[model samples]
Target chain A: MTLLITVFAAVTVTIIWYKNAPDTSMQLGTLSLMFWGASIMWFVDAVVGYMEEGASFFMQDAAEMLNDLYLGLSVVALGLIIWLVILMIKDPHRVIRSLITGTNRQ
Target chain B: MACFLVPASEAVITTVAEKIIRSKEKNDDSNNASSVPKVRFSDKLGWLNKMLWGGSALLAFEHIWHGEVIPVFPFLTAVQNGETGEMLAEMGTAGVGMAVLVTLIWGGMLAASHVIENRKVDISSEEAGQ
Candidate 1:
């Protein structure tokens, strides 16, 4: 289920990035790539889980599914946080610099 | 060890940042000949970024509401014990649903923007012909 959710998110973001590929200012491609990378990681995890648990893996209880969901959400959130930090560091719009220098009037 | 994954993830983000910078520089050089205004980073992906941040905030709130943020050690244990797992599942479902909705809305906006831009071009060209 976690892998499914991440794959869905990754695909949606990738479509958005593809539509705007010519415009590189916003860096949505980075976000898309991050989600795709995560999706691949989760896919591997799901495959390994299925291999170990065999058919029982398909019979996950509600509690187990919930736990997996939480873990997946955490991964997504962490990815966003990392992306935001990188954006700040890059400061493509000078917003971070303005904030630090106290010069931004807008 | 799981903590080590954070740095590895960060390294990927750094590579993305470098890619964006390099692309932007190339764009600037190409546009210089045509005297086109450079695209501002904030303006380009502002909506998408906001949606991502908003989703993260919602997830964080849900985590806190379920007491998963505090008592971190117990939170890990609770995963195995099935405590509050149902609530967590519901929240996760809602969070992902919201993300999908946001993406759809952004796509709609992009299509609308493209239509408006095309209309403007058509009108300008018509006026110039007149």
Candidate 2:
């Protein structure tokens, strides 16, 4: 099923990136988990929809749309998560300085 | 519409500003004290929580609009297949179920990630503080 393929790709990509990357600050484990989980769910749903008795084109279309939504959100969320991770890892000092500015804490 | 957009925009701006400030604080602490860690557990969890809530809102809106409102139009329903009701029900159930699952998983993973990350950061910060 398309959903299954998408989920597989997403999860595989995430694990590969997470493990092989020299700097895991590129992707947070939690965000990757979310992407994988959602993709898997969509994949499962698609498979089930196809096998269910009396499944129609209308229903199939709806299911596909739902999967698309999940995939889109997963990409957007992961992208943001990756960027944040990189930002934090690369400039902890600048971040710290900004926080201390105009604050009571020294 | 303007009223809605204005409040939403303001909230988004506030959130981004807060995140930048928080990240800066963490970095500052790390510098004066190399012992401090770069990221915190709560920060990751907070972002995950926000996403879950945002997703829930979108799903709810979809449920109301497609599952209820659109299907209820008199002319549309008159011409639509009798099975429209059943189809809507299925869509509603599936959409809601998936939404809930994602939200719960995200929350749980966020919590776990937070704990692990926080422990690492705490160890570093403690050393730095010393």
Candidate 3:
């Protein structure tokens, strides 16, 4: 469940990142890389679980799946929060800087 | 249960490495006005750190929420429950695999950026008709 959520986030962000490749101000690349890294990690875990449990790996009960979904969404939210921090720090377009200094009044 | 420990450990090492490289890179290069923009080694390592640290932290949180990790002496429930062997196996396989895969992907990103930077140099040189 975490794997699916992260993979979906990764793919969506990657597509958006590529589409707006020249606009590096948002730091979408970093966000996408973070998700990709997570997706790869969870993918490895799923594979290892499958190896150990064989066909039973995918047969999770509703409770377990619900827990996984919550965890997955939390991971995605944390990733976004981290990305937001990076974006603000970088201030690639100097939006924050401008807001602080009041320089872009035009 | 303790699988995220592997990548967390790797993140710690790379964080130290980044500090060392950053110290080394404190030298000046602002004099060379015509050179291509250099991507600092410390910065690249920083990207790897971000990937590793962020993922490991979230995974740790997940484990904590699942009650696999605890705020106790042994720390890990697996260790307390005599499942240390299974925990170690998960760490060896899933944890190591994730760390390696993330590092490899970071390396690929580095290579791709290097190529793009070189392309910029080529375009500028073409403008200069060199």
Q: Model 1, range B3-112, lDDT digits (tens) per residue?
A: 11232333345446656866786787777663224334333344444444434443444355455555556543345466566545533444334444444555675677
Q: Write the per-residue lDDT of candidate 2 for residues A1-106, one digit (tens) a residue.
A: 3344435555765677768666655454435444454453454345446656445723556676776566455555544555476557665346545665754433
Ten-residue segment with the worst summed lDDT in candidate 2 chain B?
A: B1-10
Best by lDDT: 3
Ranking 2 against 3 by TM-score, winner: 3
Model 3 stretches astray by more than 4 angstroms: A18-27, A84-106, B31-34
The regions of model 2 sitting more than 4 angstroms off are A20-38, A43-106, B1-35, B38-84, B125-130
lDDT of 3 by residue, B1-130 (tens): 9988999999999999999888767754443454567788899998898778877877887798889999998999999999999999889889999999889989998999999988999998898895
**lDDT (10s digit) by residue, model 2, range B72-121:** 55423312546665654554555444545554665686677678877998
Native-to-model Cα distance after best TM-score fit, residue A71 in candidate 2, in Å: 13
True contacts kept of each: 0.00, 0.03, 0.48
Give residue A92's lDDT in candidate 1 (0 to 100). 78
Winner on lDDT between 1 and 3 is 3
DockQ by candidate, in order: 0.04, 0.10, 0.54
Per-residue lDDT tens digits for candidate 1, residues A19-93, read 988876666766765565455444444554576689888898999889868876776677667668777788778
Best by TM-score: 3
- TM-score for chain B in model 3: 0.93
The alpha-carbon lDDT assigned to residue B107 of candidate 2 equals 66
Global lDDT scores for all candidate models = 0.57, 0.49, 0.87
* Backbone clash pairs in model 3 (N, Cα, C under 3 Å; residues 3+ apart or in different chains), count: 0
